[model samples]
Target: MNDHTYKITAQDNILFVDASGPFDFDTMLQYKSETLEAIEKLKHEPWGCIACFHGSGVFSPEAEEELVLLTRERMRKNMAALATVIQDSRQADIQQMQLSRVYESCNTKYHIFSDVKAAKTWLANYLKKQPN
Candidate 1:
C-alpha cells in the first residue's frame, strides 16, 4: 500500500475513510479526489461519512484546513452527518476538537469517537433519522 494514499469505502449510504500514513497537502488532495469520486459513484441517495484515523500520522495545519474545506464540499453534495475515529491521544483529542470547532457553524451533525464501531454506529443511527 502506498504510504501517501488513504483508503475509502462505501457501505450502503455510509462513506468510510481510513487515514494511513502522515497526511500532508498532497496526500489530502489525493484523498479528496478519491473520496469525492467514491461518493459520486457509490451514493444511491443521501449519505454520511465515517473517518477513521487509527493509522494516520500527524496532520499539518494546511492539511487540516483542507479537511475542513473537503467537509464543506461534501456538505454541498448531500452529506448528512460525519463521525471520526482517532487514536486515544492528547494530540488527537486536541486536533479533533479543533476540527469540531470548524464545523460548529456549518449546521452539520458531527461527532468524534475513539472506537471505530462506535463511530459507525453513530453514523447508522444518524442515517436512520433522515427522510427516505
Candidate 2:
C-alpha cells in the first residue's frame, strides 16, 4: 500500500480515516493496522472515529469482513462513537445498513453522513457526551 491509498489522523481523541478510491485488500489491511496502532498508541482511551469512504473502489468480501471484525473489537474497547461518510444514494444506504448490523450486538453508537464535515461534527459531539 502506498501513501496515496489512505490517511489516518487523530484530533481531539477522534480517529480520522480517509480512504482513497480503488480500495483493495491490501489497502484495507493497511488501514486496519494503522487504526489499531493509533488506538494502542493512545492507550485505548475512549475515542470517536470518522471514516470517509468517498470514491472507494470495489473491495473483497473477506476484506470487508475482517474490517468489520476489527472495528467491532475496538467498539468492545474504548470506541465511543463512529461516523461514516459516503455517497448519498441507495447503494450507500444499503452499505450503511449492512455496517449497522456489524454493531447490532455491541453498544457502539454510529451514524451515517453524506459529507465529512457533518461526520466530524457528529463525532466531536458524540465524544463530548461520553463519560470521561
Candidate 3:
C-alpha cells in the first residue's frame, strides 16, 4: 500500500506541490515520474518549485537516494530553484538535512522554509533574477 500522497500543479513557471509522506522507493519513483511530466508542461523557460510537505516528511534511505537523482534530473530540465515548506520544525530539520545533501550533490539551488508565503515570495524573486 502507498503511504505517500502528493498533488502537483503548475501555474506560469512555478510548480506547486503539496505532499505528505513517510515515503518508500516506489512512491518516490512515482513522484519523480509525475513531477517530470508537470515540468514538461511548463513554458519553455526556466521554472521554480515550491513544495509544501506535511505529516512526518520522512523517506526511506532508498527513497532518499532516488531523490538525489531526481534533483539532478530536475536541474537538467531547467528547474532554476526549489523552495520547501515544512511546518514542523523537527521534520523541517530532518528534511533540510536530507535535501541539502541531495541539492548540494546535484549543484541545485534550494531553500527550506516554515511558511508557504515566504517560500513563494523567495521563489518568485529567485526566478526573476535568473537569466531569461
Candidate 4:
C-alpha cells in the first residue's frame, strides 16, 4: 500500500508487475529500481518478462527522466521482454517513450501494450521465433 512499494510475480522466466493501485512519487521510482533488481535476480530466467503497470500515480519529472535513462543504467543487467501497460486515464507518454528507448538501446525484444494478453503473446511468439 505504500507508494514506494510494488508487487512482483516472478515465474521461471517471467516477472510480472501488478502495479494496479495507488502510487505516489516514490512508488514510481521504486518501480524502476525494483524492476532493475528483478531483472538481475532473474537473469537466468529462461523466457524473460512481461511487466504490467495499472494504476494512478504522480510521476515526477525526475522519475520520468530516470525512466528514459534505464537504457544505460540497466540494459546490461537484463534481456527481458519489458511490456508496460497503463490506462487511458493516465499520462504514460513518458513511460511509453522510455520503453521504446529500451528497445532501441538494448539487445532485447521490447513491446508496448495496453493489454496483458497482447504483451504475453508477443513474448511467447518472440521466444519461439528466435534461433536456439
Candidate 5:
C-alpha cells in the first residue's frame, strides 16, 4: 500500500479507517484488505463498521465504479462469514443516492447512520450480546 494510502487505528472497539485519496479502485481494495485483516480484531463478534466518508461528499466516476466492485468483493467474502457493515452517513442527497446501491451490492443487509456514536453503541451492544 502507498504511504499516503490510508490509516487503520483502533479506538477501543472502533477501527477507524481514514483514507487520503479518492475512493478509487486501488484505495477501496486496500480498504477491503484492511477490513479482512481486521476481522481477527472482531473478537466481539458480529463485526460492524463505522466508515466515515471524508472531504467532498461526492464520489468521482472512478470511485463510483470502484464502490460497486468493492461492494461485490466484500459480499463474496462475507458469504463465507458473518458481518454487519454500517457507514457513517454523508449529505441527505448523497446518502439517498448511495443507500440503495449499498443494499443492492451487499449480501446481507447493512445499515447507514449519520450518528457515529449511535452506530458504535449499537455495534457494541449487538456484539456484546452475541454468543461466543
Candidate 6:
C-alpha cells in the first residue's frame, strides 16, 4: 500500500504541492501523473513550483529516481523554477542532497527553503523574472 500523500494545486502560474512522504516508487509515479495533469490545466506558460514537504520526507531509491525523471520532464514542459520547503533541518539537508542531484542533472533552477512564505515569495519573484 502507498503511504505517501500529496496535494497539488495551481495559482497564477505557480504549482503548489503539499506532500508528505516516506515515498515508494508507486507514490512517485502517482505524483508525476497528477502534477502533469495540473500542469496541463495551468493557463500560463513558464510556470514555477513551490513544493512543501512535511513529515519524514524521505524517498526510496526507486522513488527518487522517478522524481529525477519527473523533474526533467517538468522542465521540458516549461516549469521554470522550483522552491522546496522543509521544516526539519536534518531532513532539509537530506532532501537538498537528494534533490540537488535531480535538479542539477536536469539543469533546472531550484532553491531549498525552511519557510513556505519565503519559498512562495522567491518563486513569485523568480517566475516574474522569467520571459513569458
Regarding TM-score, does 3 or 6 come out ahead?
3
Per-candidate Cα RMSD to the true structure, in Å, reads: 2.6, 3.1, 1.5, 3.7, 5.3, 1.6
Cα displacement (angstroms), candidate 2, residue 38, comes to 1.3
lDDT of 5 by residue, 1-132 (tens): 433355666555555555443455566666667776765554343444455544434455666666666556544533222222224334445643664565465554454555567656666666566454
Cα error, candidate 3, residue 48 (Å): 0.2
Candidate 6, lDDT over the whole model: 0.86
- The TM-score of candidate 2 is 0.79
Give the winner by lDDT: 3
Put down candidate 1 lDDT per residue, 24-132, tens digits, no spaces: 8788787888878888954556789987775445666787778778878888888999898887444785657766866775767999888989888888988899886
lDDT of 2 by residue, 16-109 (tens): 8876545456767777888888877543578988877755433466666767777787776688888988763445655666567665545568
* Cα-based lDDT for every prediction: 0.77, 0.71, 0.87, 0.61, 0.51, 0.86
For model 3, how many clashes? Answer: 0
Question: How do the residues 7-63 of candidate 4 rate in per-residue lDDT, one tens digit apiece?
Answer: 877776677776653444466666777778776766653455676665453345665
Judging by TM-score against the true structure, name the best candidate. Answer: 3
Candidate 5 versus truth, CA RMSD in Å, comes to: 5.3
Give each model a TM-score.
Answer: 0.84, 0.79, 0.93, 0.66, 0.57, 0.92
Residues 8-118, candidate 6: write the lDDT tens digits.
Answer: 999878899999887888888889999889898663589999998887778889988999889988887899999999865456678778878888989999998889999
Q: Which ten residues in a row have the lowest lDDT in candidate 1?
A: 88-97
Off by over 4 Å in 4: 1-5, 20-25, 45-47, 69-74, 88-108, 130-132
- Per-residue error for 80 in candidate 1, Å, reads 0.4
Model 2 weakest 10-residue run by lDDT: 54-63
lDDT of 3 by residue, 1-132 (tens): 655789999999999999988789999999999998889876478999998998787888999999988888888888999998987545767877887888888888899888999999999999999997
Tell me the TM-score of model 1: 0.84
In model 1, the runs with Cα more than 4 Å from the true position are 1-5, 42-44, 88-90
- Candidate 3 deviant stretches above 4 angstroms: none
